[model samples]
Target: MTRTPETPLPSLKERRRLREAQSLSQADVAAAVGVTRATVRSWENGRTTPRGTTRDAYARLLTGAEEVTPHQENPAPALVGAATGPVQTSPDRAEPTPEPPSETSPASELAPTLEPALGPEPEPGPDAELEPLSPSLTPDQAFDALYAFCAPALVRQTYLLTGRRELARESVERAFQLAWHRWPEVAMDRDPAGWVRATAYEFALSPWHRLRPRHRNPEPPPAAPADRALLDVLLQLPPVYRRTLLLYDGVGLNLPETAAETEASTPAAANRLLHAREAVATRLPELAEPKELHRRLAEVASAERLRPAKPTTVRWGGEQRARHWTRAAIAFTVVLIGATTLTLRTAPDHYEPPLAPGATVHGVPPRVAPGPLSAEELALRAKLKGEIASGPERLVPEAG
Candidate 1:
């Protein structure tokens, strides 16, 4: 009387539990195998038999078993039937059970079935209207999306730097405009909105633009606004000090990046940053109250939210581009003309008629003899000629 071990069968509930343990829903598994959830549910409930490829997929997914066609009958006895046979344990008398083929491994079957669903999803059309106020961004979208994304932080930063709502808004808008011109390139950059904010900060600090004749008035200076008094003091500091303060305190750039951006050594940038901090601390006591400063910042940021988006009708199309080229061409022509004219005016003139022969010496022409010299003149000429002939001989020592 030998005992035979029972072959255990997995229950439907157990199969479902296994699927759940693998982090797959019935619908997900169905989708993977191009079947309906209802079909998957029926399989899991054991309500219907899965056939053909579906059966093969199920066997592979659930138990790592090869798909056996309905026509192909197994010669070996079923495990359930084998359990009824008498147990025998002698090595030479042992019956060999055929193992399932390795091609039907669970991982291999499931992996192939699951990969198609995880590939890159197609993007929505360009003209598709975005969800209202959501950041549903596209590659070719306008710069307005970027502006909306960083508006809050930019407003806060601008207020912190300028302490004036109007100036802050202007500065931020100008920076955004500059970025918009290069939007195609900038939008692809990581943290593009942050780059714009940094550009805005630099723009606001530029002395040529910020303190230019266009920004100034001929009238007498008015009393400094209380909220912006500290900002005024900060502006009065040297440009290097201002940049160091803004980079360190306002934007939180580290010393090395700041030094690289400002073209200063790390130690020099650090010193400038330290001096700026000290200057701000020293000036804070004489400027606006802390509460007032905070209130101004909040007010400016609130105002920025209320500011309406500009009309997008302004076009920089081919016509304008052509016009720019035309202007450049005209400018180049003018420069060429001016350069040629200046060269002609400054160049020396070397043309002169050859001098006439027998030109007057000092305003008197040479006296022409009216006739041949008289005898007296001839004798004088002869005596002068004789002196000229004997002069060299007389100069030589006589016989010595």
Candidate 2:
């Protein structure tokens, strides 16, 4: 029922005439067609065009074929009776039907001028086959779809970032775990693999890895001597330079994507990649050419393919999220309680002596309201009052 955008839609003038002939209100037509009244108005005013099932249903409704549902695949045009030509109206009619628009009629003047001829919409029949609602992708399906496509390359990229194979696998597994936990957002992205790769790359660099001395052991020797040499040289470079080389050359990302993954500007990423290549070329002169360097690095990087065991079922949409929120809320409350306890325990504890009958403690300031001014202030006020009453005469006499 979806019309190709290239197909010419029914003319606004023809649609208006047909709807008037049917004596249908715009609201009545919108309700029948499952669209807004404004949408129906847009169709008749030529402000916009309708496509898909909505358009087909609108055509059928206006032409008095309300029983005919639009085909799921391709739909045939609806035949509009007496509306394809001029409309006839009687003068005595409370709302006269409008004639077909002419060259003289402005688009703004187009309005519904018809009484309701079609009675209330008919209820669905018991035997009717209503349109099937599209099934939503389950979390397991979404996770599998992304995991199958991204895991191997993501593991390889992680290995390239960190020189250790086992560490690379661990980082990749962690990234996939997090991705599953937030699959809805991850699936909606343009490059789900890119997100995984970026995440795996960051995980490989986490400081927590330093605590595990076992990770320091060298992985099995590379199959090729050239690859071994390349891996050794890459490990010696700074992390930023190493990542830029792997993402740009080893993983085959473009300069911009490389920069984005590395959290650097495009120009800065390009500069780092250039330096990284030169740094590698210095250690191995045979890889001086850019193409040869990328080829060698890619060969070394692709040495391992990671395939983690598939989860039996990835708990998809909200259940996993709700549990996570619940845990987080619990942890937050525990921390708040612990902080309150610690603060109370560490606070200064002072003992105060009981106050005498008329004595006030400094720790608690007096709450008495303000009273009369001090003697010095009262004396000054009385002098000012006398001077004000004497006015200009007192001032002249004092000057004399």
Candidate 3:
């Protein structure tokens, strides 16, 4: 007759002590599988066996312990042996007999021995579902997507500045990488596509690129490459001015939206835009001809239209435009108020008491005399009257 050997079971306290002995705190285990420390404590207390994935982790954690596995099949036998005495088994049993418990039981023995092999595993809980990895896009894949959407304008801008196709490509590529890393944050922005283009230009002019020896060389300046001149002008402009221009003209973002993006005061953004427009007009006189500039700008803008259409779904259009109008109105009101205040402060005081009615002196408003009109006044009045009478037919007989 074949005989079966019984396994031993550890009490709740023993399980908790084993976990502590291995220097695996409850919180540490909980964090690995995305659960709370309380759950781990509950499992150790025998109040519960970790359900689902957590139970799986618990099983893996106790992998080396012979007693735990045997107990899984026959819980009563394991508990009896653990509670009462050494488990006795028939010689005919195929399974090896568990050694009598030493001062350190097998559970304790297993804890320290397995600690090195056990890694943090995901904890099972109501919320412990496996998360999918973020989808990856190859550099070329990203470039194709971005180029199709905004490449034309970015290219034109690059050519306008660097005059070199390769340099423009490099600048755009760097900007795309930055966008990819911050896709979540950038995607939510009002003009994410434009933001990417601006970021690329910024990356191109970053100190790292400027430090390149080729940039420092003062060779006869090459002829302005049609494609690179724009990029050059942008890089030459200060960051604030360049950003304002890009947000306004390049990204098609209005003033208030641009202000929010650049963290500028609305008036400051407007002033920057004005200054940028002047600079561009001065540098690229060709843009002064509205028809030609618009045509070129349209080509670039259309190219960006090819970008994935979904990113533009965040409708910031109405709200942002309204914000810009409101900001402009407020600015205008402030200026009006300031000008009025200044004029009031600087004006000369000219108010004087009105002259008494019918009073006169030399045909001007008369000042009050110390006494009423006397003989002197009468004599002076008569002389004035005589002069008037000598003039035009005796003053036209006093048109009374």
Candidate 4:
């Protein structure tokens, strides 16, 4: 829609530029717009669009800031260095580079570069809330619009995948939380909804949820027999086939797009979709027709009141979660550092040989004193003196 004289919303890029020009955090604009910071971030990202009062407020904010930031464009280059280099390399490059150390968020950071499985992304649901038709939307508006548009349908989609209400809701929220975390990468994504969709699908179908106690037992199935049967069939299908069928038949994504979201080769996706449809048809022959199956999928999903949290709630939860993890990480790091320091201080610096235990010695002679001289000692001496003359003969006789 063309911007009217009354509400002149800026282009997506311009909204971000203006916010940056004004040296504002998303929180600042969010407060001014009466929306959450995440909504403002969404607007800057073009995932949603501001509408009605929010749109007008956003327009005025941008319009007014236009006057305030006129000087930024002129001085930004000199002060922060030219955008030609820094914007390309350092400034944005420095945006957590969440990829390098953890290489985690970059699945999205790197996601933009990765092509969807070999096909055009299927047209997303009516871009009504998505505002694909509204070019003048700010990123914040775009994000809010995208969330409001995609979130409900996505929740229903997740329910179909998981057959559980809470898990479905949690999965969708987690996906959006992730989307918000990597808003920059997601905002720049060719299909922000697809990005969030893939993330939600991956999370909903995650094998780990089974381990949680709450999800250990399956939720009660739909009350209607038909709904229950359809859900049972859907749940019975392999997660891959279930996702493929739901994406292609249920969500109305094209073959390639379904394959892309499922992260399978186009042929593999087709195979899964075929198998899924076959299984459903086998279970409920009435659902043999693709349209019928799609209808049933939506009907069964909607049968349950699988309400997702508000976008604002998801956004706040994401921020709180990120903060929680960050604090945990800092605490862990401090503990680790303290432990290392303690080890260094208390560790022995040099080796010292241990002393051996003392033992007794053996095979030694005992000291003895001679008794008093015998009485014969004087007689022997007198006799020997008298016998001195006979000593030679006595010695010779002794030898004989």
Candidate 5:
């Protein structure tokens, strides 16, 4: 019988830190595991957890015999791995993981074009051990802390993606609302902020974008050529490239972090970044350099910081409670009205009118016979009767 494997030793975050420590690219690990880089990332990010054989491989790769020892003199920890062990590398892959540079090393100043490691990294969950303070925080408290820290950055990045201030505000608010409703789960995530960011990203692209009227004039009157060129090129780039560029350079995330956010492999993200930069460089040679590109992107992101902070407007649970009360109140009122109407129609006591003094109510009035005529009227009647009896012969003789 096959022995049951032990549960994966390290958390997803631990595994990613291990990969970063090893300086192995994600493609390398993907090759060793016979799976895609995205699969490894999913395991790391808690999007879909690893199980069985996958978990086995994940544990082995992360918990390998290599250990990085810290030094007192040099602050940066050293990365150590078995020289003969399995390490993945593509034949045509030009970039290699650079050695750690010393504090004063020139290499430390340059941003190495490194691809992200294959494995996903975990962010600390809200319930995860936090420094100092209370032993336990309510879910609301945890969510509030997260919201306070992440809302501003989320708003700025969302605005970069949408280019509409109001829409970006709405997206961030709505995403936070979702986060609020799922507080328990969100509080347990490695990076709750990422969850909110991804949600906001989706909201930014919602079909509602089409229905809203454009706030900015499509064609502005007179602007610098470079500004016009940069805006046009940035907006015109494919969403993947545009978003990747913004996340990587504008938001100042490393390759691995950006890859995690985009759900793309480190290699794929690098490729997109390259193409996007090239596209911009081709259009606007003046800002073609990496430093210049980053400067421009940073400037754009910085401008958003001056905008007034908007508090998270979503309180999903509160809203839901209010709705429940309103619905119950309406139902109760309808029932009361129906019962009142039925009582008035069916109960005699309710329908009967009050009796008046000395009067009996009747369904119909009583009939009266004709009364006796007066004395003058009786004498006239007698004369008329006699005249009628002799009228025919007397009237005819007179005529003759």
Candidate 6:
């Protein structure tokens, strides 16, 4: 029988360690296990699991991995260019190899340079992975590199998501600012570009944008009819679906990464993607094909003159924002402490019940005689008393 959950298997991280330690890539594991490479990747990422027969195969491979001998300097296998030759993965960083598209997906049609827009990386020695942490580039220099590399494409992608040129620039700048604020974590992340990308996406799609007076109304449509129609159609989609489409079709992410970043189940992400495509296809049937859609998206994004701020400016803005928030927090803390101290110092040593509030006496007023009456009022009162004493019908002739 296949091992159940009760069976003590190595933790997921350990399993991955065992595989990588054996100088095997996910592709190699999938090849040996008779599964697709994505499946192997998902399993390692804790996205999915192995089934009965496959589980046994995986368990056997990794279980015996500990006993496997290593080459004097066994290098990790690189997945891309499999037929090229013996490729060694640099130990310093975990760069993902581009996977072949299985079908007509818009993201697949995008040139790798279109979305992340990274330059071709060199195959450095085993110590190359640690290069990011090396003293060669300071924080500012490294940040500038990442920003310069990613900002243009990321701004375009954000434009596709938000449909506003200015908002896109603002979002990308804010994301970079946040990255600078948390430079250590962002720099150490496996994919710093992705970190900034996710942040920009979140900022671009925030619902709070709707409340802003300037953003309360939709931005002007594109000058070209086709661009305008496409932009309108995209803006009509729900924020989540629109975001998913932008990430998958516009930004060229695979479904798994798209789902992970969007915080939705894979199936849910797929459904959103399908609905978004259908909506777009319904409006612009000519762009029904995935490749065409992707091309159109890139064109629309590029057509806009969404210029991002310089890296130095962005860094300075982030510094200022951080300082502002820091001072605000300190001021608030000081106010709170002062208020508490004042209360304690001036407060009575013991509890004193508050005086009962004065209440209106709901009773008749004490009888009192009037001081004086006006002459007119007095005559009118006397006349009224005479009529009461003698009825008008029984009045006698005036005899005295």
Top TM-score hit: 6
Candidate 4 lDDT score at position 45: 57
The candidate 5 region of ten consecutive residues with least summed lDDT is: 74-83
**Candidate 1 on 1-400: residue-level lDDT in tens?**
9965333436877877767666555555565555544456556756444555555566566653432221221122111111122223222211222233244332111101111111122111111112233346653355655565555456555655654455556677767665666766666543465567667777766656546665564322214454345556666778777766554444434344455457675557657865665576577753122223333334333433334234142123323555788999999999999999999999977877887999855976888869776889999888767764655766876563
Rank order (by TM-score, best first): 6, 4, 5, 2, 1, 3
Reference-based lDDT, each prediction = 0.50, 0.61, 0.48, 0.65, 0.59, 0.72
lDDT digits (tens) for residues 207-312 of candidate 5:
5567656743453411445545566788788877888877665554555556667888666776787788779888888765555666665455445432423343
Evaluate model 5: give its TM-score: 0.51
lDDT of 3 by residue, 1-400 (tens): 8964333335676766665555555555565544544445445645445545445555445443322211111101111122123434333221113334455332212111101111112111211222222348653354345445564455445433443445556676556555655656655443455577667666655667557777665333234364245445655778678666654554334343455557665556657865766676688887643234434444432332222222222123324555788999999999999999999999987978877888864755766768678898899998886664455766576654
Backbone clashes in model 1, listed as residue pairs: none
- Local lDDT at 46 for model 4: 60
Local error of candidate 4 at 295, Å? 1.6
Model 5, C-alpha of 388: deviation from truth (Å): 50
* Per-model TM-score on C-alpha atoms: 0.40, 0.48, 0.32, 0.57, 0.51, 0.69
Residue-by-residue lDDT tens digits, candidate 2, 1-400: 9946643455777787777677665556766776544446556755456666666667677677774333322211111111223334333221113344444433112111111111112211111222222248676776776666566656666676787878877777777777877777877653566777788888898878878889666678677888888888888888999998776555545444455568775557756866887788899999865556656655665555545445443233335656888999999999999999999999878978776898755777676898989999999999888775755876665633
* For every candidate, C-alpha RMSD to the true structure in Å: 25.1, 25.4, 27.4, 18.7, 13.6, 10.2
Ranking, lDDT, top scorer first:
6, 4, 2, 5, 1, 3
Q: What residue runs in model 6 are displaced by over 4 Å at the alpha carbon?
A: 1-7, 12-34, 51-135, 352-400
Model 5, 263: alpha-carbon shift in Å? 2.4
Residue 367 miss distance in model 6 (angstroms): 18
Poorest 10 consecutive residues of model 1 by lDDT?
110-119
Off by over 4 Å in 1: 1-142, 151-174, 210-212, 218-226, 285-400
